[model samples]
Target chain A: MKSLKIFLLAGILVASCTNDPVEEQDSWPVDFDALVALNCRAIELRKARFATADSLRLDMDSIKASMNQSDFEKYQNDFETRKNALLSESNALADTIRLRMKGVMSDLGPDRKRVFNDSLQATLKREGCE
Target chain B: MKRILTLAIAALIISGCAKDDEPTVQETPTKSAAAKTYDADFMIDYFSLQCDIVRNTNGFLPTIAARGYGYLGVTAYESVVHGIPNGQSLAGQIQGMSAGSLPLPSADLKYDWALVSNKAMADMMRYMFGVNLNPDDAILIDNMEANTKAQLSAGVDADVIARSEQFGADLADAIYQVSKTDGGDESYLNPWQTPWEVPEADYCWIPTDLQLQPLSPDWMNNRSFIANIAEDTQIGAHIPYSSDPQSEFYAAAMEVYNQVNNNTPEQVTITEYWADDPFQTCTPTGHTFNILKQLLAESGATLEKTAVAFGMMGVAENDAFISCWKSKYDYMLIRPVSYIQEHIDPDFTTVIGTPPFPAFISGHSAEIGAGIKVMIDLFADAQGNYTFTDISQQQYGFTPRNFDNFYDLANECALSRFYGGIHFTMDNDKGLELGIAVGDAVVNELTWPKNIQ
Candidate 1:
C-alpha cells in the first residue's frame, strides 16, 4: 500500500514538472435578479421622494400636516419597509459577488482592490441613504 | 426653385413681423353671412355655425350659442362617446393604462378647454349626422347659422330652432343606444361619471369597494365619479323650441335648468334661482357652444344620419370619460395638487407648486388627451379646416390662416393644455399615448355604415 501511494506521488511530481496547472474556473450561483429588483425599488422610491419634495412648494404647512397624520405615517412606514427590503436584497447580491470573487481572488487580485472599493462605496452610499 | 426659396425666406421675414402689423378692416361682418360665415378656422372651440347663432344681434343667436356652447364646452367631450356607438373616449383608457406610473404615463388633471375646439365641434357634427357634409351642406350650415339676418329670415324663431335641436338631441340619445346593442357589456356608452351601484371593475380607476376612496359628492369634481341624486346633480332637459314655439334663449336656459331639477329623484332640494355674485370677473362669462342638431337639417345630413353620428360621438366621448375616470380612480394615487401640497419636496420652489394630488399622472391631461383622439376620428373623413386667433380679444375665428383639415386642429389643440397650466410635460406625453390608443381602438372597433365607407 505504501509503495503504491509513493508511485502515485511520483507520477504527480513528474507531471507537475512538465505541466502548467490549469486555472480553476470558480462558478458561484449569483442572484443578480435580487440586485435588479433592489435597484428598481430604489428608483421608484427616489421618484416618490422627488414628487413629495415638489409638493412642498404649494402649501408647506398642509403637506407636512398631511404627512404627519397617521395614514401618511403608515404610508411612510410601508415605504421604509420597501426600502429595507431593497437594501437586504442588494446586500444578498453583494454577498454573492463577494463569495464568487473570493474563490477567484488570484485572477481578480488586481481587480479586487479597485472593484471592492467601488462596491463598498456603492453599498455604503445605499445603506447611508441620504 | 429660386423664386420659391426667395418667397419662403420673404414669407418667414414677413411672418416674423407681429400680427398686429397686418392691416385691419373696419367692416364688422356680423350681419353679413358672406363675410361672417365660419371661415376655415380650425382653432375655434365651438362650431362656426353655433358661433354664428350666438353672434346674431337678434338677441337670440348669442343666447342660442351660449346654451349650445355650455353644452359643448362642459359636456360635449363626454357626450361624444355617448353620441356614438362603441365611441370610447381616450380619457378613460389613459387613466387606467397610465395609472400608478408618474414618470412613465403621468398626465395633468383639470378642465381641458382644448376639447371644445373646431375639430371637436365638427367631429361631433359628423358623428351625429353620419354623412360627411358635401361642400354645399357645410357651406349652408356654415352660412345660415350665425348671421342675424340669415337666421331670422330662415323662418324659424329662436324657439323653433331650439326645439328642433332639442328633438334632434333626444333622437340622438335614443340612437346612441344602438352602440350597445352589439357591444356586449362595453356597448353601454356612459358619457359622464356613472354612479355605479357596486362601483366598477376592469378599467375602473376608482374602486367602489375601496375603504379609503374619496367621496365624490360632486361628480364633476372627480373625472370618474358620478354625482348621484345625493349630490348636486345636473340632469339634462329637452326644451324643443320647435315644439314650445314661444321659447326664448334665456327662457330656454331657465326652463332647461328647471326641467332638469324637476326630473331629479325626490331625494334632494335645489336652489330656487341661479344667483350671481356680481363680483365675478367678465372672464367667466364668455359664450359656449351647443351643437344645434337641427342645424344638421340645414346641412342636409338626414335626421337619422345626424342622430347616428351625433349619438356615436357622444357615446364615445362618454365611454372615454368613464374609461379615463376609472383608470385614474383605480390608481388613486395623487393629483398635481397633492404633489404641489407636499411640504417635503425640495424642487417645489423651482416649479409653480402642484395641486393637491399625486405627482405622477395628470387627470386633465388624460381626459383631454383621450377626448381629443375620439374627436379627431369623427372628422377624419370630413372637410374644412380649423383656425383660432386670439386677436385684440380672445376671438378664435379672427385669424385668416388656413388649415388643411381637422387633424391639424387636434394637433395644436392638444398643446393648449400646456398654456392652461393643467398638465405637465410627462402628463401630456402619457395622456396623448392613451388618448390616441383608445380613440383609435374605438374608431376602428365601431362599425361605420357602408354608405359612408
Candidate 2:
C-alpha cells in the first residue's frame, strides 16, 4: 500500500510538470484595462521626453545661429552626440513597452487581440496621451 | 497474487506518466497537390521579420532600404512565379535581367512554392543586410526559416523539399548577382559623401546637421529597375528662388514659418507619426512596407498575391527614390528651414529636425505616394476605396491611425512634412505627382499574372 501511494504521487507530479504553462495562463482572465493604463503612461513619458529634447534642440539652434563656423561645428558635434544618446534611451523605452504589450496579448485570438489593441488606442487618443 | 497486483499498479502508474511526457504532434494539412494551395502565412511572416530587421539594422537608410526591398521583392516573386497560372517571370521585364537568367525548377517535379519562398527570402535577407545584421536578428531569420520549413515539409516528399530549397537558394544567388551591378551596391558604407562640394548657389541645399554633408548625394546615379521610369517620373521644376518678401519662393518659406509657429497639437502628432527617422524607425520605405505586410495578413492573401504585391511595390519604391533624388540634386533647392531663417523669420525653428538633404521633393511624400498607389491597385475596389487601420507605428509606442482610403494616408503623409516646416507645399505636391506617375508605370508596365481574384 505504501508503494502504491508513492507511485501515484510520482505520477501526479509528472503530470503536473507536463502541463503547458502557456495554455494554463491563457485560461486565466487578462487585465486589459491595466494594460491600457500602462501603455498610456508609456506614451505620455515618451511624449514628454521628446518635448524636452525638442526644446533643447531649439535652444541649441538659437545659440549656434550667432556662432562662427568653427564654434558652430564644434557645438554641432557635441549636440549630435547628446542627441544620439537620448534617442537610444527613448528607443529602449519604447521597445520595453512594445514587448510588454505583446506578451499580454500573446494568448488572445486574432479577433480579440485586434479589438483589444483598438480599444487601447481609442483610450489613448481620447485621453490625449498619443 | 498480492505481489502481482502491486506490480500491475506500478506499471499502470509508469505508463500514465509516460503518456503525459509524450510530445503532442500537430496535425499537418493534407499534402498540397499544387503550389497555389499553400497559404501566404510564411511569406507574410518573413516580410514582417524583414521590417523588424530594417528597423534595427544600423545603416538601412531609406535609399539603401529601398534598394534592398527591390531585390527582396523580385526574389520573392521569382521563387513562386512557376506556381501561379499564367504568371510571367520578371527576368525579362526588369533592367539588367535577361531571359533565362535564373535557374528554373524541373518541369515534372512537384515543388512546394512556400518552401521556395521561405528559403529564398531567408537567403536574400542575409545577403542584402550583410554585416549590418545583428546576431539577434540573424537568429530570428534562422528560427523563422526552420519553423516555416517544418510546417511546409510535412507530408511532402523529401525530394520535393530538396528541389524547392535548391531552386530557392539558386534564385536568391542569381538575384544577388543582379543587385551587385546596380550602382548602389554597398552604398551603405559611405552614405553621406563627406567633403562633397556643395553647389555654391543662392538656392542650393546647405547642410543642417553635424555631419555637414548631404545624405546619399550619389543615390540618384543608382540604376533604376524600371526602364525610363526615373526619367519619365521626374518633377518639372521647383518654384524659382527669390529672397524678395513678395516672391512665391519667399511666400513658400513664410508658409513653412507660420505653420511651424502655429502648429496645433494634432499637427505635431501627424508629423511625429510619419517622421520615420532612420536608426529610430525603418525610414519612409520600411514604414510603407510595414503597411503592406499588415494589409496582406488581414486579407488572408496567398503566397502568389503577396509576392506580386511585394514585387510591384518594391519596384515602385526603388524607382521613386531614384527619381526624387534626381530632381533633388538637379535643382538643389534650399530647405524650408534655411530659407525661413534667412529671409522670413530669423528666429524660426521647425517642429521636427530637418533631414540633412535637399528638400525640393519630400522623400516621404514621394515614397508613401508610390507605396499607397500600389496598395490601392492591389487591395482597393474599382472606386479606389479601402478602409484599414495603420498600426505600423504602434510598435514604436504611437497610437494606431485609421484611414478610409490609401490616397488620404498618402496626402496626410505629404502634408505632415509641411506642418513640421521641413517642406514647401509645392515640394509635396510635385512629389506626389512624381510618385503617382511612377506607381502607375509599375502597375501598367509589369506583366503580372492576371485573374488573381
Candidate 3:
C-alpha cells in the first residue's frame, strides 16, 4: 500500500510538470545540424530531378529533329507519360522534405526558427538552389 | 677676329638647342571622359547581392522588387555621373526629383567613381531594406560595406577617398529623402497587405487555393517612381468575364487549359527558364538585369555607358510595374486557374504555379518589353545581330540558353508566360505593348546629352 501511494504521487508530479499535453507531445529538441543536412539532401534531390528532366528534354529534342512526324508523335506521347510520372515522384519527394522542414521549424522557438531558416537559406544558396 | 669669335659662339648655341629638341618627348593624348571607366566589378557584385536579398526576403512581390532595383540603379548612376563627361543628372527630368534636390559634385577633383558608387549602394541598401532584414542579412550588409570600403582604401589617399565616399553618401541621402515622401516608405517591402476586399459585383476575383491570400493587392496605392506612369498608361479593357464556354473570356480560359494540357517539352523548357520564380532565385527583374550585366561586360562598354544603361533599365522597369499593377487592380480579373477549375476542368492544374494576384497584364511581359526596348535604344544600333549565351541560371545546373538578339530573348520571355499557363495571350501581348511605350518614353523624354549619345 505504501509503495502504491508513492507511485500515485510520482504520477501526479509528472502530470503537473507537463500540464500542456499538446505542447508536451509536439515539442522536441531541434538538432540544427541534422536539419541543415536534411536541407542539403533536399537540394540534392531537386538537382537530380532537374538533371533527369533536362536529359529527357534533350533526348526529345534530338528525336524530334531526326524523326518523322508520326514517329515523333508516338515518342512524344510516351515522353509525356514518363514526364508526368517523374513530376509526381519529384513532387512527392519535395513534399516529404518540406514536411521534415516543417517539423524542424515547429520544434524551434521563434528566435531559433529564424536562425535555422537563415542558415538553411545560406546553405541552399551555396548548394546552387539560389 | 672679334666678329668671328661671336659668330662661332652663336653657332654653338644654335647647335645646343637643336640637340635638345632631338631628345624631347611627345605628349600622350588625353583620354576623353567617355573613355574613362571605373571598376564596375563591385556594381555587379552589389546587384548579385541584391538578388540574394530579394530571394531571401519573404513575400517580396515582383513590383516591390522592381521598385527597389529602380532606386539602386538610379543611385548608382547619379553617384558616379561626376566621372562621366556630359552626363546629365536625371533629377530634374524624372518626376518628383528636382534640379534643386541634387548636390552637385565638386569640380576638377579626382574622384574614385567606384568608391562613390560603393558608398551610395551600401547606405541605400542598408536603409531601403533596413526594416525587413533578418540578422543574417544585417551582418551581410555590414560585411559588404566593410569589404567595399577596404577595397577602395587600397593605394588611395585617405582624405580624397573619404571626400568621394561622402559625396556618394550625400547623393544617396538626398534621393532617400525624396523616396520617403513618395508613398513608397509606407508600403516599402510590405508585400502582403490584406488583399483589397473584392466588391460584390460581376466578374470579381474569387479565391482559388486553400490559403486564399491574394498578393500585393494594395500595390497600386504605392506611388510610382514616374508620376505619369499611373496617370498616362492605358491597359484599355479585358473581355468581360463570363461563364459561357463560347464567350471570349471563356475562350481565353480554354486556351490556357489546352496549352497546359498539351504542353510540349520545348514549351516546358521555355516556361521554366523564364519563370524566375520564388526562393533565393533572382526574381524576373533581377534576371533581366543579370542578362544586361552580361551584355555590358561582353560589349566592352565604358563604366559611364554601363551606368547609363542600368539607370535607364531601372527607370523603365520601375514604371512598367506601376503601369502593369494599375491595370491589374483596375480590372481585378480572375486568374485562369480559378476560372478553369470552376467553369472548365475541375481536375486541371497549371504547367507552372500561378502567382497570387489578379490577372490582366502580365508583369513578366511588361518587364521584358521594357528591357528589350531600352536595350535596343542603347545597344541595338551596335549589337542588333549579336548573339550571346545566357548563363544566368548556371548555378541551378540548367544549360545556358542562347539568344540571337535582345528582341528574340524578350519575345521568348513573353511566350514563356503563356506556355506556363499563367497568362492569357492578350495579357502577354498587351503587357509587351505597354512596356514598349514606357521604355520609349523613358528614353526619348529623358535629357541625355548629345555628346554621350
Candidate 4:
C-alpha cells in the first residue's frame, strides 16, 4: 500500500510539471492573436470615426461661407455639439480597447508581454491599420 | 533494503517537481558591483509601463506629465547612483534638493542596482499618479516589479535583495517628500484652474474650445529643477499684436492660414503625428520619453547610462514646460485659428483642433526642442546627427517617421505645430529657442557622472 502511495505521488508531480507548457502553447497564441485583432479593429474604428468628423467640419465650413453671423453661430453651436459627441464616442471606444488590451497583457510575463506587443505592432503595420 | 527503496521514491518525486528553467541560487560572477555591468531592461520596462499609465490616467496633460517624469527620473538615478563609478547624486545640483536627500546603501554590502531601480520605480509610480492610476495600470506596475525582482533576484544573496529593496523604497519616500514642495503636488486634481480671470487686452488668448479652460495657468509657479532656469531663458517679445493686414503679426496669421489651407498630404501627416494628444498618445513629454527609450534600447545602454539620460531629459522637460508656460501666459497671445477667423478670413478653420491655452510659445516645440537637445548630446556626433526611425507613434496608429539628424527632427516637430495651424511662426521659433536654452542648462550645468563604466 505504501509503495502504491509513493508511485501515485510521483505521477502527480510529474503530471503537474508537464501540464503547464501544453496549456500555455494551446492558449497563448490564440489569445494573443485575438487581442491583436481586437486592437486593429479599434484603430480602424477610430480612423473611420475621425474621418466622419473631418467631413462634418468641412461641411460646416462650406455652409458658413454663405450664412449670416447669427445663423452661422447657431449652426456652429449645433455642429460643435454633434462633433463633440462623435469624438467622445470614439475616445470612449479607444479607452475600452486599452483596458481590454491591459487585461489580456497582464496575464503574460514581462518577456512574453514584450513579444506580444511587438507582434501586435507588426500586425497593425502589416495590415495598414497604423 | 525497503527503507532505501522509499528514499529513492522520495528523490524521484522531488526531481520530477523541479523546474528545468529555474536558475540555481549560486552567485553570478558577471553581476559586478559596477552599475554599467547590468543591462537597462528593468528601467526600460518600467518607463514603458509609465507611458501607458500616463496615457490612461486622467488630467495628466503635458505640464503635469513633465512634473511626474522629473520626479521619476530623479528617483531612478538616485536609486542606482551608488553603484555607478564616479556618479554624483542630483541632490546638490538640482534646486531645492540638498545633499544627502536620499538614503545611502552601505559601502560594504552588495546590491542588485536593477532590483533597486525596480522597487524605486514601483513606489514612485504609485506616488506620482496617486488615486488617478487605473486598476489595470496598477496591475501592470505590480507585475513588472514582480517579474523584474524575480529575474534579478536569482543568484543574488537574500540579504542583498532585502537591503537593496529597502534602500529603493526609502529613496522613493525621500524623493516624494522633496517633490511635495515643487508647487505641482496634486496639480492633477485641478488641472484647469477654474475661475481664472482671462486677460481682456487685445490679442490676448480666447477660448477656442468650450470644454477646456486655460490649462495650469499658474504652472509657471512650479519650482524648476535647475535654479533660475526659467527666468534666465525667457523668450524675447513677440511681434506686437497688430490687426493690420500687412503687419508682421497679421503676416504670421496669414502664414498659418496659408499653410493649413495649402498643406500637402505629407504635411498634414506630420501635423497629426506630433499632435501627442492627451488620452490618445501620452502627452508631448511622454512622446519625448518614448523616443529616449527607443534610442537607449537601440544603443544597448547600460543601466547607469539609461538612468542618467532619463534624469537629464526629465529635468529639461520639466523646466521647459515651466519656462514655456510662463512665456505663454505672460504674452497670452491669440491662437492662429482665432486670429485668422476674426481678422483674416471669417470662415477659416485649422487642420487640427487648437489646444485651449495661451499660444505664445508652442508647448510641443519647447518640450521636443529640449528633449532633442539632450538626445543630441548623448547620441549624436559632432554635427548633431543620429539616424534612426521613430516607431514611437506606431502604437497610436501613425506610421514611423525617420530622421537623419536630431536638429532636423526638432525643427520638424516645431514646424508640425505651424502646419497644424495651431501655432504661429513666432511661437514655434521662440519655443524652440527657449527649449534649447533649458536643454543646454541641463546638459552643461548639472554634474552627472564623468565616466560611466
Candidate 5:
C-alpha cells in the first residue's frame, strides 16, 4: 500500500511537469486576454491621473504668476507639497501596472518573449502611456 | 459523513490533475467581419525603429534624414490607402508627384494593410539606409521583417498573402524611384560624397569645431516636398550682420553670451533634452516624430490615421528644413560663437557644440514649429493645449520630459537652441514663424483623406 502511494505521487509529479510543446508555442501559459483587459483599465486610470496632475501644475503656474515677492517662499512650499502628493500617487499606479506587466511576462517563453514585449509596448503606447 | 467528505476531496484533487493532463487547443480571439483587422501597432513600432536607425547612421545629414523619413512616410500611407475606404493618394497634391504616378490598390482585392505597411517600411529602410547600417542594426531590421511576416501570415490564404506582399514591395519600389531624383542620388552608398562647397562671402559660414564641410549646402536647392519653384519661401529679414558694439547683431550675440553666463540648471537640462545629440540620437525631427507616434497611439488611431499623421508631419518638416536652409545660406549668417568670441567674450564657449551649418533660422525651431502646428490642428483643445510626454530620446538614456501643450513644447525647443548659444533669438523666433507657415501649407494645400476614427 505504501509502494502504491509513492508510485501515484511520482506519476502525478511527472504529469504536472509535462507541457505540450505545440500548445506552449501557440498559446500563453496564462490568460493573455485577461491581462490585456486589466492593462487597458490601468491605462485609463493613468491617463486621468496625469491629466489631473497637469491641471494642478497649471494652477500653480497661475498662482505663481500673480504672487508678490513676500508670498514667493510660501508658494514654493505649497508647490513642493502638491508635487510630492502627485508623485506618490503616480508611483503607486505605476507599481500596480508593473506588477501586472510582470505577471504577463512570466508566462511568455523565451522565443515569444520579444514578440510579447513588443506587443505590450505597442499597447501601452496606443493607450497613451510612455 | 466525515469519511464521505474526505473521499470527495480526494476525488476533486484527482479531477484537477486530470484537467492539467488534458491537451487544450486554445483558439486566437475572434473578430467581427466588419471590424478593422490591420495592425496599426506594427507601423508605429517600425517607424520608431527607423528613427533609431537614422539616429545611429553615421554622416546622415539632417536634410538627408528628413528626405529618407519623407519617403518612408509616404510609402506607409500609399501602402494602406487602399484599405481605408475614404483615403486618397497624396500624390499630385505634393510637388513632383502626379496622380497615378504610384500604383493604387485594386478595388476587388482583399489585403492585410499591416503587412502592406510593414513590408513597405522594411523594404525602403533596408534600401535607403542598409549600406550604412552596421551588422547588428542590419540584423534588427531583418528580424523585424521576418518575425512580422511570420506572425501575419498565419491562417492567411497562401495566394492572398503572396499578392499582398507583392503589392507592398511594388509600391515601395515606385516611391523609391521618385525618391532618387529628389537630389539624394544613391546618398546611402556615398553618404559624404558630392561635397558641399562653402561659398565666399562676408558672413559665409566657416567650419566650427569637429566639422569639416558645410553640411548639405545644396539641400536648399534640393527638390522640396511642398512649395513650388516660384513659391515665396523666404523668412522675414534677419538683423543685418555687423561687428559694431551698438549694432543689432552685436546685441544678439550679447544675449547669447549673457544667457550662457547665467545659465541656470533648468536651462541646461532643457538644452540637453532638445539637443537630441549623441551621434546615435535622432535630431529634432525624430523627437517630433516620436511625439506623433505617441499621440496617434493614444487616440487609438486606425491605419489611415496613422499614415496621415506621419505623412503630414513628414511633408511639413522636410519642406521646413529646405526653406530654412535656403535662408541660412542666402543670409550666410555668422555663428554666435564666432561673433561672441571675437567681439564680446573671447573665452566664451557654447554650452553645446555648434553644428556645421550657418544659423539664421534654427532647424530645431523650424521642425518643431511645423510639427506642433500639424498636431495642434489635429488634437489640440479649445485652449490649444495637446499635452504629451517626449521619450524619443529615452533609448539614448535621456529621461522623458512632459509638456503642457504643443505650443509650450515648441517654445521650449526654440529656447533650447538659444540656451545652447548656437542661435540668436531671431533665428529661433523667426524660424518658428516660417515653420508655422510651412506646416499650414502642408495641411491646407494637400487634398488628402481625413483621419479614420
Candidate 6:
C-alpha cells in the first residue's frame, strides 16, 4: 500500500492550486483523511455508543427497575467515558485535518490558509471526526 | 517678467490642488447609505432591495445562496457571542404579535424574533458542515453552476459576494413578510391562506396567468422521497469532507429538539389548546393527518400515490426539521425574547414565553417552510401542469395570502408557524428560506443511479 501510494504521488500534484478548471473539478475525489481515518474513527465511536445505548435501554426496561445510587453513578460514568473518548478522538482528528490544510496552504503559500484551516477544523470537530 | 509668471503658475497649481482636495468619503452616496448600520439607534430600518435578481424557478442558485448566506450569518453571530454553547434570539416579539396577544406594533413592537432565529440557524449549519451541494466539491460555487473553486474562488469579484448576501437577506425578508400577515393578525403581502376550501383570486399576489400552470414533473414518481429523507439524506446531504458518526449533527439535533419540545405550556399562552382538536370536536376530520389525507384525495390521485407522496414529504420535512434545529443549536443565538424581555419590553413574553434559547434566527419557521416546500415540490414535480391557484384556502388568524407554487407553499408553511404564534417575522422569513434550501439540496443531491432521478 505504501509503495502504491508513492507511485501515485509521483504522477499527482497533491497541493497544486491548479488553474485548469476541468482538471480541478472533483479532481481529488477524496480527502483521504476524511474518507478513511476520520470516517472510520467516527463510525467506531458511534457504533460503540449506540451499543451502549442499547444495553442501557435493556437494563432500564428489564433489568434495572430499581438501582442503587452507586449503580446509577457507574452507568453515568460509563456514558461519560464513551462521550469523552469520542470527543477527544474527534478533536484530535480535527487537529490533524487542520494541520494538513495548513501544510497544504504553506506549501502553496495560499492566502486565507488560516481561515480554511480553522473553519475546516471546526467543521470536522463539530462532526466529531475521531 | 519671470517672477510674475512663476507667481501666476503657483496660484494655478494651488487652485487645482484645492479643487482636488475634497474628501474621498462617498463611494456612490447611495451605495454608502445601503451599507450603513441599521442597528445604530437600536432600531433597524431595513430597506428592502427587491430588484429582479435572477432566481431559478427550481434549481441550485437559491439553494446555494441560502446555505452559503446562512453560514455567513451564523459565523458572524457566533463570533459576536463566543464561549457559550448557545446565544440569544428574537422569537418573543413575533410570538406576541402572532397571538394577537401583543398590542399592535405601535404600543411598542420591540425586537423582531423572526429575523434573529432565521439568521441563527443559517449560521449554525455553516459552522457544523460548510455544505457542499455543488458536486464539484468546493465552497465557492453553486452546485448546478460549479466553477470548480480552483479556477474561480480566486477570481470571484467582491460584488458577487455582496449580491449573494443581499439575495439571502432579501429572501429572508420576503419570507418573513409572507408569514407575518398570511393568516396571522399582521400578514399583508400574502392575501390568500392555505388548507382552505377554494381559492380567493384577489388573495394571491403572483399574476393570474402564472397561477394557471401545474408543478414540475420529476417530483411525481419520486414523491415518496420525503418519508425516507434523513436516512436518504445521509446520502445526498452528506458534505464531501464530512467525517462519520456526525456527532455534531446528533448533538445539534438533540439540542434543537429539546429547545423546541422543552417549552412548557406555561411559557406561551398559545399551543396549550388545539384550534379544533379531535378530542374537543366530534369531527373525525379534525385530525391533522386525516385532513391531509382528505386533501390528497381531492387531488384525484390514488391512495398509494398519495401515501407515497406523503411519505416522501415526511422524510423531507423531518430532515428539514432536523437540519434547521441542528443549525440553530450549533449557531445558538439568543432569541428576540432575550433582547426584548431584558431591554425593550418587560411585559412581552414570546409565544415560547420562557425564552430558554438564544435567538439569531428562526429554526422553527425554517423547518416548517422546508417541509412544505419539499412536499409541494414533490407533488408539483409529479403532477405537472396543474396549477393549484384558488383550490385550497384558509383564513388562519395570521395570514390570508393565497399560494400557487412550491415557493408559495414554502411561504405558507413558515407562515403557519407565525400564525400559530411561535416565531417572529425574521424567524418565519429565515426558516422558509432555510427550508427551501434544504429541500433544494435533497432534490439535487439525493439520487438512485439514474433509475431514480
Which candidate's TM-score is highest? 2
Question: Model 5: runs farther than 4 Å from truth?
Answer: A1-130, B1-36, B188-195, B229-231
Which candidate's DockQ is highest?
2
Ranking by lDDT: 4, 2, 5, 3, 6, 1
Model 2: pairs clashing at backbone N, Cα or C within 3 Å: none
Task: Give per-candidate clash totals.
Answer: 95, 0, 0, 0, 0, 80
Report RMSD for candidate 3.
22.0
Per-prediction DockQ comes to 0.02, 0.16, 0.01, 0.04, 0.01, 0.01
Clashing pairs in 4: none
Q: What is the overall TM-score of model 1 with all chains considered together?
A: 0.30
lDDT of 5 by residue, B243-338 (tens): 889988889889999998899988976886787653334677777887788677656776767887788887887888888888887777888887
Question: Which of 3 and 4 is the better model by DockQ?
Answer: 4
Deviation from native of the Cα of residue A54 in model 6, angstroms: 41
TM-score of structure candidate 5: 0.71
Q: Per model, how much of the real contact set is kept?
A: 0.04, 0.26, 0.00, 0.02, 0.00, 0.00
Q: Can you write out model 5's per-residue Cα lDDT over A16-58, one digit (the tens) per residue?
A: 7784322332355555555555555544444443444444333
Worst 10 residues of 5 chain B by lDDT: B26-35
> All candidates' TM-scores?
0.30, 0.81, 0.71, 0.77, 0.71, 0.27
Docking class of 2: incorrect
Error of 3 at B121 (Å): 0.7
Which stretches of model 6 miss by more than 4 angstroms?
A1-130, B1-292, B350-360, B381-402, B415-424, B447-453
Ranking by TM-score: 2, 4, 3, 5, 1, 6
lDDT of 6 by residue, B1-453 (tens): 999999999999988886322211111222111111211110000000000010111121211223222222222222111111122211121111122221111112122222222233232322222222222322212321222222222443455433333433443343333233312211111212222232223111111111221111111112122334323322122112111235442333233333344555332212322121101111111112222332343344432233233333333443454445444433343333333333334444323222223222354455445545444554555422223322111101111122345455445444433433334445556656666666665445432111110
Model 5: how far is B148 from its true place, Å? 1.1
Task: Tell me how far the alpha carbon of residue A49 in candidate 5 is from the true structure, in angstroms, after superposition.
Answer: 34
In Å, candidate 3's interface RMSD is: 14.2
- Judging by lDDT, tell me the better candidate of 1 and 2: 2
- The docking category that best describes candidate 1 is incorrect
Residue B59, candidate 6: how far off, in angstroms? 37
